[model samples]
Target: MVSRVLVPMDDSETAGRALRYALDVHSDAEITVYHVVGSPSMMMGSAVGLALEDDIETAATERAKPVFDRAHEVAAEYDTEIETQVGLGHPTRAIVARADDYDAIVMGCHGEHSENITRGFLVGNVAKTVFERSPIPVTTVR
Candidate 1:
């Protein structure tokens, strides 16, 4: 019954695991691999430079290429093809905004930069926020 499934991914092993899980569990559903590029920060991070480009949308897409490439590689392991999407701004907000179009959301419990030695929590901010705010069912893979 689930015709559409959304799997948010990044350049992380856990995200790859989540994608594989979705493919195995919902093989019949259309899968969309989404990657969100964080918005520019005042601290002049790489994202800020990317946002300053002539075309911000294109910049975002280019930044997300690595993630999408990995997603495609993973999808190939399952002998399936998946649609890829790139979003800008906060990861949680971007994903939640599109959650309504899918039957469910599947993602990693933490991301590439999720290791917070200061906070002592394993869950990434994006995953935590999405898990809390998503209107649709969310499945988080460790």
Candidate 2:
């Protein structure tokens, strides 16, 4: 039984679809919708722009809040319990680390590949990383 399901969402429509699919398949479970704030290492900033790095990270986290809020609203249709969280680090690693805490993970394999979700993980780097490292079951959505 899937006691909890976690999905790492972006602002993409694919993520929206994945979350919806997760809800339908795992109804009545507690779901955690998470968004990983990109770490400074991922940013290509010059020495001058580095001064605003902290602010940029804060801004990124703040911007993800509303998208997760929408995810919360979407969870209501399935009569599921939902929680939202934001983390800072490599997206795939962070998600996989927490995957063990949840029974399964439901996510969009392709961040933006609308035509092919089957090969989504291969083409999409983050999904590939999570797929390789996830300790639990992974359901990839288009």
Best by TM-score: 1
Worst 10 residues of 2 by lDDT: 42-51
**Lowest-sum lDDT 10-residue window in model 1:** 115-124
Instruction: Supply the global lDDT for candidate 2.
Output: 0.75
Number of clashing pairs, model 1?
0
- lDDT for each residue of candidate 2 in 1-142, tens digit (9 for 90 to 100): 8879998887767788889998888887778898876555435432234336667666666767877888977877665667888876667888988998899888886664333554433337777678778998888886
lDDT of each: 0.88, 0.75
Over 4 Å off in model 1, which ranges?
116-122
Error of 1 at 105 (Å): 0.4
Candidate 1, residue 82: lDDT: 100
Which RMSD values do the candidates have, in order?
1.8, 3.9
Largest lDDT belongs to which candidate? 1
* TM-score on alpha carbons, each prediction: 0.92, 0.78
